[model samples]
Target: MSEHKPVPGHRADYRHFHAIQTRWMDNDVYGHVNNVVYYSWFDTAVNHYLVASGVLDIERSPVIGLVIETRCNYFASVAFPDQVDVGVRVAHVGRSSVRYEIGIFKEGEDSAAAQGHFVHVYVDRESRRPVDIPEAMRMALAAIAVG
Candidate 1:
């Protein structure tokens, strides 16, 4: 097996943040939160930001973001009842797609326990065709764009 290198991310690296509470069911047989739960957290954090920013309206929006790709790297284990602070940043924004980088940190910790990214392609909800990001959405994305 090959050794994996951890992607280091600090709280200061992100421009936005969202807090997630872990439930008792989040823990698996191994006594730590399951790996799959991390992905859910990622989705929650990003969509929440978009909705709160008035860029995404799940039910009424003509333009919607569809996740096309996702990846994650885990460096530590977290159990139930632990609050997670998710750091969010836009790594890249294309004409119809945006790459969102996220860092999951244990509450009050400085460094991320896990880090990953998801790419979302903006598309028309009805036609399912790629659409250019709206100007307002573009501006919102720029606010979180990272180097």
Candidate 2:
């Protein structure tokens, strides 16, 4: 594997964004948002976009995306009172999987507090077998594809 240095990101680096409110429970003993909570934000940002784009129906879709891999790099800390702006973009799209890159920014900040990516493989909801991405999903993802 290649060494991936934790480089901070900027808002302009992402294609879309969703506002996420940090809950008090999200903070750890350090008084900042816990590392695990960032992953939840990542999931929320990506899934929300998919659902809003009409590409995903969590309850009724025959095909669903299953997270296959994920990673995050924290550059700074965020607190409960902060409104996190989660920026999302598609780094790559494959036959059955898509790599979604996410950036968590403290509201109004130009630089990202955290940045990372998760790979989701589309699969049969019942059979759990990999399936080609649907046309609607492909189009939606393409809209967010990063150069």
Candidate 3:
């Protein structure tokens, strides 16, 4: 881990939040939520936000954001069936890519159970080439940037 550690009361510059319940299968042999599942949570958080914000029309949008990179830091163990709250923020917004950072916490708890980040590069639906972020999307992402 880095010198920096996530602590209680830390709020991400997230415009919205969503609650997710951990499923029993989310755990691996050791009894803690597996590392892989954390990444999925990151995806679910960002996608759900975009979908609800009307920035993404998963089925018919002429534009799409593709995952270009990802990273995570697990500070503590979270078990299955636990109520988890996710906080998200836009760390960086580029011409065609946006970097989203997320923190996972146990419901009713303060500090994050884990933290992670992922970058999504928006591109043309058909060409799959990078494209400038639409104004609407930019506005949506800005709402999530940490001050």
lDDT of every predicted structure (CA atoms): 0.94, 0.96, 0.87
- lDDT (Cα, tens digit) per residue for candidate 2, span 27-105: 9999999999999999999999999999899999999999999999999999989999999999999999999999999
Q: Model 3 Cα displacement at 135 (Å)?
A: 0.7
Among the numbered candidates, top TM-score falls to: 2
In model 2, the runs with Cα more than 4 Å from the true position are: 1-4
Per-candidate count of clashing residue pairs (backbone under 3 Å): 0, 0, 0
Tens-digit lDDT string for candidate 1 (1-147): 998677678999999999999999999999999999999999999999999999888899999999999999988898989999999999999999999999999999998999999999999999999999999999999999999
Best by lDDT: 2
lDDT of 3 by residue, 1-147 (tens): 568655543444445577999999999999999999999999999999999999999999899999989988877789978988888888899999999989888887767778878999999999999999999999999988865
| Model 1 TM | 0.96
Which one wins by lDDT: 2 or 3? 2
TM-score for each model: 0.96, 0.97, 0.91
User: How should the candidates be ordered by lDDT, best one leading?
Assistant: 2, 1, 3
Task: State residue 66's C-alpha deviation in candidate 3, in Å.
Answer: 0.6
Q: Lowest summed lDDT over 10 consecutive residues: which window, candidate 3? A: 6-15
Error of 3 at 11 (Å): 3.6
